[model samples]
Target: MAPERYEADSDPTDLSLKILVAGGFGVGKTTLVGSVSEIRPLRTEEQLSELGESVDDTGGVDRKTTTTVAMDFGRITIRSGLSLYLFGTPGQDRFWFLWDELSQGALGAVVLADTRRLEDSFPAVDFFEHRRIPFVVAVNCFPGARGYGAGDVSRALDLDQGTPVVLCDARDRDSGKEVLIRLVEYAGRMHTARLLDTVGRP
Candidate 1:
C-alpha cells in the first residue's frame, strides 16, 4: 500500500489519529516524536542526578541525565489531508500508570527497542499485549547497539505473525514517519479484521 502523505492546511479535527510511542528509558521515543513533529514537541524532562543512582538503571545509558517524566506530545501531517498526534509515553518504570489512561483512546502504538538493551522493552510490549492493543515494533537503530534484523526482533518479542516490525532511526524524520505509517497500516488491517468478524465473515 502507498504511504499516506499530508500537506499543510489540513484540519486537525478531520484527520486526528492518536498513536503511542512506548519503550524503556533512553530508547528514543522522544527523539522519534521530535523528528517528525510539525509542531513544537512538548517534553517534560527531569534531570537525573547521582542521587537517582538508587532508582535509575545506569547500565548502558550511564551518560543520560534527564528522563521523560511525563508524556511527549507531537503532531505530524503524513498526507495531503491526514494528520497524526504522536504521544510518547514516559519510559521510566514509575510512570507506567500514565499508560493506562493514554491507551484508552489511542488507535495503536509503536514500541521502540534499542538493541543494546532489547530486554528493556519487554514491559512496553507486555503493556500493549495485556490490553490487546494493536501495535508495531520499531527497532531503533543506534550507533553502538547490537545489529539485529527485524525478523530476529520479531522472534525475540514473540509477536503475532501479522505484527509489523521495522527498522528506524528515530533521529531521522523520514524514518520516524515511516514507522508511524507502519503503525497506521497495522491498525487499519486490525480494524478491518474486527469489522469482518463482527459481520460474521471470515
Candidate 2:
C-alpha cells in the first residue's frame, strides 16, 4: 500500500500517523518519546529485579534501574492537521512479541542508537529492513560516549544508501522532534518511489 501522505497544506481535520520509537535496552527509546510528546506519555515500565538480570543486559546502561515492559505511548502535533502518535517498543528480547501489534499501521520508525553499545541496535535495524518499513537511525549522544559523524555511523551500521543517520540528544525535545520530522520525510519519499515502481512495472 502507498504510505499516507502528510503535507503542510493537508486537510483541516486531524491527520494522525503512527511512529514507532525502537532500539536496544537503555538506548533512550523512552526518553525520546517522553521528551517530544506534547501530552503525558503512557509508559509500561517495571523495576529491575534479580529474575531479569540473566536476560536483560545492563552492561552499558548500568545505572538504569527500570525497563519498559510493554510499550510507551505519546503524541506530538507537527502542525495544525498533522500529528504523530509515538509508540516506544520494549527493548528486551522477551517483549519482542508485542512489536508486531504495535507496529501495525505505523507510518515509519525511529531506531535509537547508543554509541557505547552500538551493536545492540542491530536487531531493530534488521527488523525494520526485513519488513520494508522506512526508518531513520538517531544516534543518542550519551554523556561520555564517543561521538561519530553521520557518515561513519551509517557505514558502521551498514544502513541503506539513503537511510538517514542523525546524531541527537534524545533527552532534548527539539532534537527528538527533528528526528521524527526526518522519518516522516524519508517515509514519504520511500512511498513515492514504491508507487512509481509499481506504475512502471506494467
Best by TM-score: 2
Each prediction's Cα lDDT score? Answer: 0.86, 0.90
Best by lDDT: 2
Tell me each candidate's TM-score.
0.91, 0.93
Pairs that collide, model 2: none
The residue-level lDDT of candidate 2 at 110 comes to 97
| 40-101 per-residue lDDT for model 2 (tens digits) | 99999899899989988989895899999999999899877889989999999899999988
Per-residue lDDT tens digits for candidate 1, residues 1-202, read 1123333364654566788899998888988999999999999988988888788886887468788988899999778667898889988888988988877777889999988898998999898888878899999988887889989999998888988999999999999999999898889788778778778895
Screening candidate 1 with a backbone cut-off below 3 angstroms (N, C-alpha, C), the clashing residue pairs are: 5-78, 5-79, 5-80, 6-78, 6-79, 6-80, 7-79, 7-80
Model 2 segments more than 4 A misplaced: 1-12
lDDT of 2: 0.90
Worst 10 residues of 2 by lDDT: 1-10
